[model samples]
Target: MSVTRPVAAQFEAYNKRDINAFIDCFSEDFRGYRMPAETPSTIGKSALREFYISNRFNNPELRAELISRTVLGNKVFDHELIHGISPTPLESIAVFEITDDFISTAWFYFP
Candidate 1:
């Protein structure tokens, strides 16, 4: 599968509020963190699922708009605008690392 596929699948599943599909896009050892931080906020698929369920899936109106994307080998960088999470829309960038057809790690940045 293309490196960008997991990233796309993740967003698709997230928008659809399909937790199982979202979890499927990630590796069992998945790790996620904030940009420029070495420490991860989320580790493993189970932790990721919990984070998404509590923070994203609970928001029925949540939606993300892709502003731009760039792919370089196993990495996919996505610029996005997310709505309905907070009082106003949020602009962020997420970098996904794909390995063995699954997302191994991801880093999110908000400006």
Candidate 2:
């Protein structure tokens, strides 16, 4: 199956602020990193859940609009326009690596 399913599912879950569903898109040992960082900012589903619950899902105004998506093999890249987390809209490129139908690793780039 295509890796795009998990990527798209997570996007929908993010927009809806559905923490459970959002985390469900990721693997149990998921690793998430912000660009330029050498280590994963968030690791494991438990950590991922805690981070998003406090930093994202709790923010009522936060929403990410998908600008575009490109998938190559097991990786999915997304161009996103985010609103409400800051004073202005933020542009980000997020890459998701899927394994066994779940996202195993992710990288977020803000430029």
Candidate 3:
């Protein structure tokens, strides 16, 4: 299976704020992190759900549009972004490590 399909599905869920659907795109042992300081990693579905909820509450109009997607074996590098609050959009690069079940890991960067 190509990473594009899963990534696209994730984007769909994210746009809809469908937490169940969004988290479904991740593996059972999924872990994610935002760069700069990575000591405390977000592990498991519950943690990720909290992250999404907080984000949604903070930025009600947040939405990501894929700028580009590159697949390398089990990994997918997605350059995308969120918009609506500020004039200039916030850029993000999601490094997705996919597994048989779902995406195992994600590392995000904003610059």
Give the better candidate number (1 or 2) by TM-score: 2
Q: RMSD, model 3, all Cα superposed? A: 1.9
TM-score of each: 0.96, 0.98, 0.87
Better of 1 and 3 by TM-score: 1
Each candidate: what lDDT?
0.93, 0.95, 0.82
Give the alpha carbon lDDT tens digit for every residue of 1-111 in model 3.
777666778888988888889888988778888886565378988888898888673567878888999989888999987775468888889889888847888898888
Show pairs that collide, candidate 3.
none
- Where does candidate 3 have its weakest 10-residue lDDT segment? 55-64
- Sorting all predicted structures by TM-score, with the top scorer first, yields 2, 1, 3
Instruction: Give the better candidate number (2 or 3) by lDDT.
Output: 2
Off by over 4 Å in 2: none
Candidate 1 residue lDDT tens string, 28-85: 9999999788899999999999988999899988999999999988899999999998
Candidate 2 residue pairs in backbone clash = none
User: Which candidate should be chosen as best, given lDDT against the real structure?
Assistant: 2
Report each candidate's C-alpha RMSD, comma-separated, in the order given: 0.8, 0.6, 1.9
lDDT of 3: 0.82
